[model samples]
Target: MYLLLVFRAMRNFIVVGHKATTTPSFSLEDIPGTSGRLDILCRAVTAAFVISHGIRKDVCVYLVLLGGEIPKTIRLVGETLRHLNPDERTTAALLKKALAVPATPEWAMSTSGIFVRTGGLAEVLTDLKDAKLIYLREDGADIRGLDAPGKDSSLSGEAAFILGDHTGMTPEEEALIEQAGARVVSLGATSLHADHCIVLINWFLDTNVFMSG
Candidate 1:
């Protein structure tokens, strides 16, 4: 009976994306509480990978950037895989893909009162850092921290504001725009005329594609 239970668990692990080459070997003695050592072995192996895979890539990048041997990163990734939740392990894979492409370009938009003017240099690029869309470099310029393929200048004015500021919108404002399927842009320096601001805000808030599943 114990052997049969162990076999069943092993089959389940194989079905759930375990690669045969890297699977760990387990002996009955390795597991203390189990009546069936084989079953415990299977559980240990599956649990280890499911929890660690998501964090593996990030940890690898960190270690490599620090000038350490690359092999160490691989071992660390393997180690981290032992502790992450299974869902997080799966999501990490998806996050890696999502981060592969640049989300949008960064450009400056002008705001007057409630009105936003797309195009032209941003009156205040510094404010974008506060919104988390861009990070301030040592030189005091805001830059996209993610390794996006194209030149930073390729970003459009509207895209910059949208990426920079939408996350900070008020719940009411966000809800209304979300309900209307509108795109939101960063609210920067206020315009002189409220009507123009309204038009710009409305336009900016209505243009993004939702990608999260």
Candidate 2:
């Protein structure tokens, strides 16, 4: 029953890659890492949590760190609200802690509604879909615009989206997402930071009453 409850609580997601974790240690001082930038990850996760209405929703956020001592991946389910402090401090602190955590192949609740696991861009994408959630990669391909009217209808079932970090998705990462069979999606032509992209995506989806309903 506990397992079943966890499954039902799953919400749409937004995965972003932080290819800058080239730091040798898991310390916060090392954040915005020489390689993996925690600042980007912090902002991205915070933006994903604080959507248009300011009401928190169930959303999973993935930070794929490529510059870490071991190239780790961290997934945080939306349940970190209780511990989330104003500003990005709380998020930053949690990420610091998550970085020091060991890798887990299965989804494990790090706290209440929050879950974390160690993996990479492709692994997380594959796992979420295997759990029956629809995954989409935000891209500029011939795909549909997230804000396009009626575009919401095309995305049925639980869904998740992926974006790139400061340096943007690596060519290899793009191929990984593509290979996973994720539908390519776009959000206009202008390029924005990963955190900004997340806010816009959530706002667009909220305007459609996707999660609220």
Candidate 3:
């Protein structure tokens, strides 16, 4: 049953890097410095998909970049994910390359499992496809006391955890999230890196699912 749940469940991590570059002009060596703290999103990608021995094939990661004139969303689906190692630099390269692709309001495949779209947080919220949208906030309800995730019919057995970058979401962004009716959840009092939070959420679901199954 544990193995069954592990193979069948789907988990999504969406990180909004408000200052991250939307264009592909940032230097590879300065992802954090020049890319406007894109290093944070890169680390979150590692946490979402990387695991011992292999990738988490059941996971998908969303990166929203809002620095350039237009906001862009880069998606990485782990089931068919390839060419992604567990390093931040290479991941940064992939993200940069994805942004370099031709702009499309619709999703355009930059690589095998990665996709780039010309939109931001609001568009993503409407594309949930019955997935429950959860906002990770320090003041929300504690995440420790939740039921098994991705099992509700109303949600079509899907859920996505949305996080903000180092600078956190702007007030306007926060208002948009709340307006979308996001279920806010807390990780604790102390602040944590977005990547670390992703790890914690993944572990919470994986462990709880294994135990429950």
Which of the predicted structures, 2 or 3, would earn the higher lDDT when compared with the native? 3
Local lDDT at 131 for model 3: 71
Cα shift from native, residue 119, model 3 (Å): 0.5
Against the true structure, what is each candidate's TM-score?
0.14, 0.74, 0.90
lDDT per residue for candidate 1 within 1-213, as digits (tens), equals: 355331101000001111111111222343222211222223322333332334212111000001111111011133223333444233232222222322223321111101111111122232222221221112322222222335343222222122111122235433433443322322343322222332332232223112000
**Alpha carbon lDDT of residue 172, candidate 1?**
48
Model 2: per-residue lDDT, tens digit, 1-213?
355332323455555555545233545555554435677777887787764445365677777777654556667666554476445656776766655455566655554555556567767776776432333334355333332434543443466777776666767877877787666666656767777777866665555543333
* lDDT to native, each model: 0.23, 0.59, 0.84
The number of the candidate with the highest lDDT is 3
Candidate 3 lDDT:
0.84
Model 2 vs. true fold: TM:
0.74
Consecutive 10-residue window with the lowest summed lDDT within model 2: 130-139
Best by TM-score: 3
